[model samples]
Target: MAKQDRAVRTRTALIESAAALFDSEGYELASLSTISERAGVSSGALHFHFTSKAALAEAVGQAAVQRLEGITRPQVDDALQALIDVTHALVRALDDDVVLRAGFGLSDSIERVRVAAGLRDKWQGWVEDSLGQADREGALASEGAAQDAATALVAVTAGLETLGRQDEWWLSHAPLTRFWQLILPRLAEPSRLDVLVASGSKGGAPGL
Candidate 1:
């Protein structure tokens, strides 16, 4: 049991180290030797866990998906509030979590190569689902507006993460908060407007 636990830890370490390098150095530029060295593991051990850099990247992507699931899986009574909350949590996650940043980076970076669908797709799907729920609950001004908001939100999220790679301020609370402030009013019905905050709910997800 101890051996298995240690192996798991070692694998996690390699993934995290690779993610950091991938986040900072780009996937093509981050070498296996550096990843193993950063993880404090032998190259043989890295090879034992992952046969190739692409394989390692695939693992990183999968691990990131798990984290995304953790953020989006919880069911909330107010879906629009839940949407605001998850977006806030996601931006913060991108700001701080190298693994997540790398996962998103890798998704965009490795698009031509064959791999799983990108994390953005998953996030966009969740956004669409949340808005759909809001429409069902009569929180949205109209179904069409909710769809437009979903597209804009996903695009803004992708753009923010891209920009945040160069400047942390893009991922800071103000950008998303301002974005919500502008769009929420147009997207939501008048009665539901009071319930939403562009900055997110105090009762929301992990970041806030």
Candidate 2:
């Protein structure tokens, strides 16, 4: 039991160290030796946990995906609010800078390439499912184009991450928040539901 516990600790440390290094330096430049050194574990111990750098990278991606799945998997009661919630959760999930840098930005051709590819597919499917649900609930306007719109949403988020690294200017200029805000209104008819923020005292338009 003690041996197993120690192994688990070592694997966790290695993954964390690898993720941090991958975030600071691109995957191509980061090395297993460096990761092992960072974790204060011998190279042999690192190899026992992850046979190769590719394996370690794959584990990092998996860990990140697991974290995101937990945050974004809630059943959204209000379609409009659901998207908003998803956006908020996604942004928060990226708070760990390494997640944005290594999980999404880096190439995923690790030893477990299939597993990495599955993660990408899972993301696309999740987006499609969420968009489909919103469309049914009259929270989105893509009627005939929900799939395309969902794909575009994914693309934009990925692009924003890459652009965010290059310059802070993109952070404010990017229309991520606005894009969703604009789309949310178009998804359903105006009178079907209140578009503006609800208040105790009525008489104001939807707060834009």
- Name the candidate that leads on TM-score: 1
lDDT of every predicted structure (CA atoms): 0.87, 0.64
Write down the lDDT that model 1 would get: 0.87
Worst ten-residue run, lDDT, model 1?
Answer: 109-118
Candidate 2: residue pairs that collide: 140-187, 141-187, 196-206
lDDT of 2 by residue, 1-208 (tens): 9999999999989988888888778778889999999998999999988888878888888777776676555543655455455544554345444653467644465444445545556667777787787678766544665776777777766666666667644444234556665554555446644652221112111111
Query: Runs in model 2 with CA error above 4 Å?
Result: 107-112, 167-175, 192-208
lDDT of 1 by residue, 53-136 (tens): 988999899888888888885445799989998998999989888888888887875553233246878898999999998899
